[model samples]
Target chain A: MADPAYRAAGEGALRIEPLGELAAIFDRRSQQTHLVTQPMPEILAALAAGPCDATTLAARLADSFDLDGEGDAAAILAERLDELAAMGLVEPV
Target chain B: MSTIRTLVDLLAGRRDAAALAPREWDGVIAVARAEALLATLAHRLSGAALPQPVAQLLGDARAAAAVATAQAMWEAEMARRALGPAGVHFVLLKGAAYAAADLPCAPGRQIGDLDILVARDALPAAEAALLAAGWEWVKEDAYDDAYYRDHMHELPPLIHKLRDRMIDVHHTIIPPTARPNPDAASMLDRAIMLPNGYRVLHPFDRMIHCAAHLFADGDLAGGLRNLWDFHCLTRDFQARGDCDSGTPDGALGYDEWLGDMGYRAKLWGLGPAVRRALHLSAALFGDEADYRRLSLGDRLFRARLLARDDWGRETRPLLRLAFYIRSHWLRMPPLMLARHLWTKWRKGRGAAR
Candidate 1:
């Protein structure tokens, strides 16, 4: 199967503010604020730059932060993208 | 750079931090803070190489503004949720709208209060919804409350009991009696809806509303910030070619928009206020002829706006009072003004006792 391409739901509509370990994202589209920790913001930032599939996103994430080698990074990124999509933060492009 | 000139230049996006002396930073910051433009100043000066202390001060201000803006967004959401069930879709106004829409004038802007507009008929339902959701009338005096309902454009300001944030729910840009009774329905119909389902005034309506509010409604105490809003919004619209486009069907052109909003006479005062504050007029009013014709009112507004001393104290108290009287005069007829001032004076004396 082709890798699923993912994009942020409201690209320009989200305003992100980092608060220590957590980040606050205000979606102007939904008018709802979501607080997320770690790789979620990193993931969103990546998608914000441009749309990318899970394999490409995992490679992008690996370039920035240390990832555990025990698990497949592509699988981990795909799971994270699923969570983000459910939260209305991202969608399949 | 001269401190006032530097401040104006910075706001106009013509960066020249190299020429500023260390001693002048304190005065410039003081003036900007007093005018509630510190956040805007911080926003403009961001990323430009500056003295360490100046950069740090602006950084801190910008951080604080970001937090406030987030809180404002949350508050707006709460308002929408509370009012939406009652079929009330409120129109966000001023700073809140700017921030919500992510307009150019929004970054680093400080919102003092949340202002919204609803159809006059929906006001009662809107107020009830807010009150039921913990918003309380900020004014306790019966006469003041009555005055707001009977004569003003908005309800007495309300405060969230738990959040302690104030919200002004207005029905029209100006009081019906004060201006030519602008077509509130037309404005509401033409509002631009944001992705969040909230709406803001159309760009043209927004500009005229700011002009009217600054020049016709109040005593110009915070006129500088308001005029900057006028300048930025108008310029943005012009740059986008929105102003140059032919008038939308059933909508007024720029000149007619001003007149319909009851800013025709006040624009005379506002024109000079903008020119004096920013030292630029061509971009704002299109031509110098319109501004030149309004020089007399411009002088009055300019004196009032620029009267503050180094410490931000009004240097020309009499001129300020004259402007204050002028604002009241513009708001009501002579007889009503006399009665209103008398009542306010009596209330002040009673409170002193």
Candidate 2:
């Protein structure tokens, strides 16, 4: 099956506070605070802007960061997106 | 004079840092920070052609204020959700209310706690729901708990067990013993409900409550920020055509609808103090006649409002005490006030010992 398109739960619903490499996000909908790291923050920001599939998000992330050519960045991003979805920070649009 | 006046003018949009001396900026920033108004000052002074140093100072304060405000918003939302399941509708009050309603006064404003006003009858249920949701009463002292239940307008505050944030659930704006006894029912009837199911006081009632809170409730220690709230709420409501225009007779024209609320003297006193603090004229608040009646009181309040040193310490300690006594006097009967003061003093002395 094709990977489902993902997007942030809603605009302005998450309050993110970055402390060095780690960040805290307070989800207004679930009233949950989640501590996230590195590429997750970038991923959330991208999804918050608008919905896109893993391929599109991977492309954007590749441009923003230096990715190793040995492995598939899209699969890594898809795994991270699933974890975020489980946390209720993002949803399949 | 330069510090307070410059800060006021900056907030009123009448002046910018270009007109202030380098030495004055330090005092101005100090006073603003002391009064918990640094963020508000920062927000107001944004986009002005301020000196680079002043701009940086405001930027840092604004960023800090934004974080504090965001945390406050989260607490308020938590309170709303906790109380929602019990079918209790509560009205957000003061700083929390301003932020929740997205009022103009909210940007960069500092909120210390989450305050919500529920109907007196629903308070028990509301309290139960909050407790069930992990909020615990903050006061454990027997006397303080009794005092809150018997004399105060609100319950002893509750703190979220997990978050360590405080919430004050008030049933009314003022103590039940206060002489004015504002119509809580009327005020509640006029509350505006937001899409999120949270309610806020009507513009007129909110303004009156702010005036009463500053002039009659406590020592005027935080009067500057309270007065700013009054100014912002009035300006916001007037711009929206939500408030009645004052009369030409100059007899506190705004009091036409407010006269029956029974706090005319207190409301009248707030007019001149706010005017003096913001460098505004009597005409701005529509209480020239009332201002004339309370001119001496106005002078006293203005002095207290401006008597703070750069560090926000009272320059005139005696004057501060006098106003402190005056606030208690306004809140209760003479005998009750004396008795209450004695009890508090004794308790404090015992604690010290």
Candidate 3:
């Protein structure tokens, strides 16, 4: 098994949290990460309510206006979740 | 006559790849892009336009982005100390160099750290230098460290103190215990130095190194990726054919077993990609048959060894004890195993406070 923190979910989804002080959360879904911005706190909160997939999270990306179009919604959420997982804020349930 | 069409055919038909599941779509995309960039780089380096099929097969954006990151990091690290006479020679090994030179495969396809081979005499100082520079030892277990130092050829792993980047520093590509320990020192001695004094393993040794790394190493978990590495490297070797162009030595040429690797990939059902890759790279890579014949037993051995992880706790200790016995027994004669066991027992008793 891979390190538990980077486990895979069903098809097209991944559960990621950071293992430690690594900045930038990883998106298990996209297997990438997004650098955090001030608007990220709001974005992350919206994601916490449920097990949202990449397409859903992209539609809810309200704070990425300064950035262009959806701005890697899948990659951003996954990376944030990875960071949160590393911090023990989120988990694959 | 139809190079691009052939590649598209290979990619399109191999859609049922068991290992290429969509859960790893991101990794897949990353690998595709990396392969595309590699094709471009090889074209530039060899001064020949890469065939259309090769370019199309590699053009995935995700894999390319990761390769771009790794390449940038590698270049920055090399450039930072490029001019100084700090006696630091950074030679990229395994996937990075292979991808840079040949192979339409992406570097990110095999997700792992960058492996660099330094001279053996410089091993200790190099380790110290990197440690001081910010890479921390990720594996702290003494037994594991001893295993790498004594039995293997390099350090375990080191992760960047700040960035999440990781690197594996090495003195040799193949372990000393594997087979008739190929003449590593001689290979290094003949290694060609690129501009900036950075050295790469002599072509023959580099090919053999890839073979040794994939087959001889104990890491079976990455078997699929390892096979992919072998396949890609073989293809790249065929392309340049410049490294070992004049060598009369049988072992120092790529002719020995490049075909064998291709045959083995097919035999193990690694899909037609291996065969296609061999043809695409013009048989510059592994010989499928030779590689297959040599590695069959080792692959079986690794599969069994890996299954030890799935055993229940009741059987786990027995397995561990068996490994302890086997590892010691084969490494030495009967007397040595007894002697070693006695020493271990005595040490355990002493620590039983």
Candidate 4:
């Protein structure tokens, strides 16, 4: 089987409010306001573009933002994807 | 003026933050926090002139309340989703209801638990649905659970295992054993369904429920915040000429509205409580047009409602104890109250030991 793909929740379900350096995501499903810093919001925004596997998502992030530690970037991103999944913000596709 | 009074005055818009010493401001802020009315005061006095520190505190209060509102609404949503498909009808009650309808009392209002009123017959299904949705019993003691089931208006409180949020599923607004029994069936009959699939009580019923919660069911602890909710809700009605969805055409006065043969017959056996609530509101918020001379009992009630010292500590211990007993008295018969307290004391001792 190919690598598992994850998708961020649709626009209507999650409301993103910028809080200075961080962002507050009011998830309507969980009724939780998640205060997330950089890379998390950026990852969610990237996922919002479309569902993708970890490697593809890492490349998408790399194309625009200059990511730290380019060699293990996908590995770092897969961990973050797991975190978002646990938060119910992202789901396996 | 007393700090509690000053706080209420500020909250009610009868007084502004004009010419206040920093120490006095500190006292007022303390009292407001004690009453859980800080965010409300912040919202009410948002545009008024204020000290820089006080303004910053109020701004923080507003932010905290926003988070609270979101949590409370989310809890309500979860409850609805849990109970909806089971064909159980529940109208949101208290602060959750206000938040759902986005009423005047919604903004900056501190919410505790999700209170939803279901029909007496829907109790079993509602409880089962909630349990299946990961809600466990909050009351473990057999006696308290039995008391809740046998005498109280609601189920033994349920706390979700995952969310750690509590929900009170009520078949009526007040306890069945209480003297004043507001018609839950009729109130539910008059409930309006919002676009979001949540239901709210009619405007008048909402005020009546608030008044009952303050006087009949509770000991007037944190009564100031409850009274402020009553004030905001009533003022919103009076501002809009009392032409709520309940009264499509402009009604005459609250008296006529309550005395309406149709309403009185179907609901509102608890009209006196609403009357007292309005009289107290008028007296406190400076609505002289509707104010009445408060009876001695009413005066004591007001005193209890405003029972706060300068440092935000609760004052009037004797009065507090009396009202606490009175609340229990109102909940059940005298003998039952005594027995219940005895059992509770024994249970508490057993647990401590």
Q: Rank candidates by TM-score, best first.
A: 4, 2, 1, 3
| Residue-level lDDT tens digits of model 4 in B1-353 | 88887887776676658767778998899898999989988998897788888999999999988987987787886676578778898999999888887888889998898899999999999999989778999868787888889999899999988779899999999998888878889889988787677888876788788888988888998887888788888777656644435455345565565455225433555666776787787778754522348887788888898889889999999999999988999999989888989998998999999
lDDT of each: 0.74, 0.75, 0.48, 0.82
What TM-score fits each model? 0.71, 0.74, 0.47, 0.81
DockQ of candidate 2 is 0.07
Q: Against the true structure, candidate 4 has what lDDT? A: 0.82
Candidate 1, chain B, TM-score (2 decimals): 0.85
Please give the lDDT score for candidate 2: 0.75
> Which candidate has the top score in TM-score?
4
Off by over 4 Å in 1: A1-93, B241-294
Off by over 4 Å in 3: A1-93, B1-85, B106-108, B139-141, B194-198, B243-353
DockQ of each model vs. true complex: 0.04, 0.07, 0.02, 0.21
Per-residue alpha-carbon lDDT of model 1 for B123-201, expressed as tens digits?
9999999897778988799988988998998889999886678888999878766744566777788788877577888
Write model 3 residue lDDT over A18-90, tens digit each, in one string: 4344336554433445455544445455565566554555665644444355656556666765565443234
Leading candidate by DockQ: 4
Please count the clashing residue pairs in each candidate, in the order shown.
Answer: 0, 0, 36, 0
Write candidate 2's Cα lDDT for B260-296 as tens digits: 3224324444443333433322212323313334456
lDDT, residue A60, candidate 2: 76
| Tens-place lDDT digits, model 2, residues A43-90 | 987776689988888777777788775248887888899778656577
Worst 10 residues of 3 chain B by lDDT: B306-315
